[model samples]
Target: MTKNFNDLVADLSEIEGGYAGHVPPEWLQGRTAYGGLSAGLALAAAQKAMPDLPPLRSAQVAFVGPIAGDIRIAVDPIRRGRTASFIGSDISFEKDGEWPMGLRTTFVCMGERESSIDHVSHDYPDVPPPDIGKATSRGQALSFLQHFEFADIKGNPNQGPADYLRWIRVAERDGLDPMVELMLIGDALPPAAMKLVEGFGPISSITWIANVLTTTPETDDGWWLLRSRSDYARHGASSQVMSVWNTRGEQVLTGMQGVALFL
Candidate 1:
């Protein structure tokens, strides 16, 4: 049976070193699972290993290989400082009699302290609000997409600038940690290069770096603005600048992703 994000998360069992979990095929993208789910699971394992750790400030994730079926996430606390803690988590599983690493993540969790300076470097995209009554759709018929709701804003790439803008939210968001929630929805959009390609092709995210702008990232009615801009695309690879904002027009998270495109 297919399981939602919350249900899957609740099934994670704590092992000796980390957490053990399973990913159903309904959440798989091709041979692997969704990028957001892997990254979110790594973060979730890290949180479970150290419950008192501070809020997640930033995360650096490397997608090494395909991860499906039963998985083991080993968490290692690299260091703990007065206000910040650094932890490393690795997701791996045995397949075909060989253990292949699926994902490796380094999390920087820090507590907020008074700073002498504060500034805003970006603003929310000037897009219309997400219509809750409108129907949601997905660009591709990937199996994992059914877990989330996408209200895409149609546009023409020839107008002025080109980008993928949409409002996305999890279909099952009850009782989710704020940090875990961000990880789940942050990488929900496909590579911005998908619009630039003519026909459909396989694509995978190689690396992703996310910075948490605020500890308490909240939006109205679970709707968050998602924008992905591919500034460079060439030579079978592409890079995108990703951002997520709340309904109150607050910038919550900023991310950069490197995708390996097989055009």
Candidate 2:
């Protein structure tokens, strides 16, 4: 039987080693793999290599090629230290009996470091909750959004813009692993939000980076705020910056993405 969207996402949570591989079904797109799936799998592989370290605080990934067909990924440990650990992994798709499509990622774990100075300089827009009433799932009918609820704060479905605010919370049980939750949320913001902005035309992200500021978000059962904006777009490319906040309003993650927008 085919795996449902939630089932696939749940399976991603448990992927380790090369076992994270998936067979593309007829309904799924064959030209390019979803960035979220690749990112989640890479993060999972990284976490497996550094099981003893603190939960994943952040990850950055670069998509070098299209992962359309069958592929394999190998994870390599770059650095393992007392205070932090770094891991690297790559995905390659099979092409002409050889693997192609390259994707690289770095995972970092921040150990117990305390700082008395607490200062934050970012501010979120005071937008009302996105009309949960108008959220739509795009790309390969079985999108990750089907597993959760999404609300759009800006950009109408009819018109395209570059900025968007979304409220997301898993409908499943509370207390999910921090790294897994981060992987899920981190991958959700990039593509669709970038498409909404007009200047960034038909661009695709070549790389994505996310940094986590708090570790407790995994155990909290609350809404997370994803405020995303495109700062600039030029030469058929653009960059987006996003801030993630827990329901209590504490910033948890910050991310930026560079996209290849086609006009």
Error of 2 at 1 (Å): 4.4
How well is each residue in 153-200 modelled by candidate 1, as lDDT tens digits? 766343224378889988878888989999999999888988886767
lDDT against the true structure, per candidate, is 0.87, 0.63
Clashing pairs in 2: 161-196, 161-197, 162-196, 162-197, 202-262, 203-260, 203-261, 203-262, 204-260
lDDT for each residue of candidate 2 in 165-247, tens digit (9 for 90 to 100): 67776554254456666666665655544555554434466888888887666324435777667777777777888677765
lDDT of 1 at 149: 81
State the local distance difference test value for candidate 2.
0.63
Alpha carbon lDDT of residue 74, candidate 1?
94
Clash pairs, candidate 1, are none
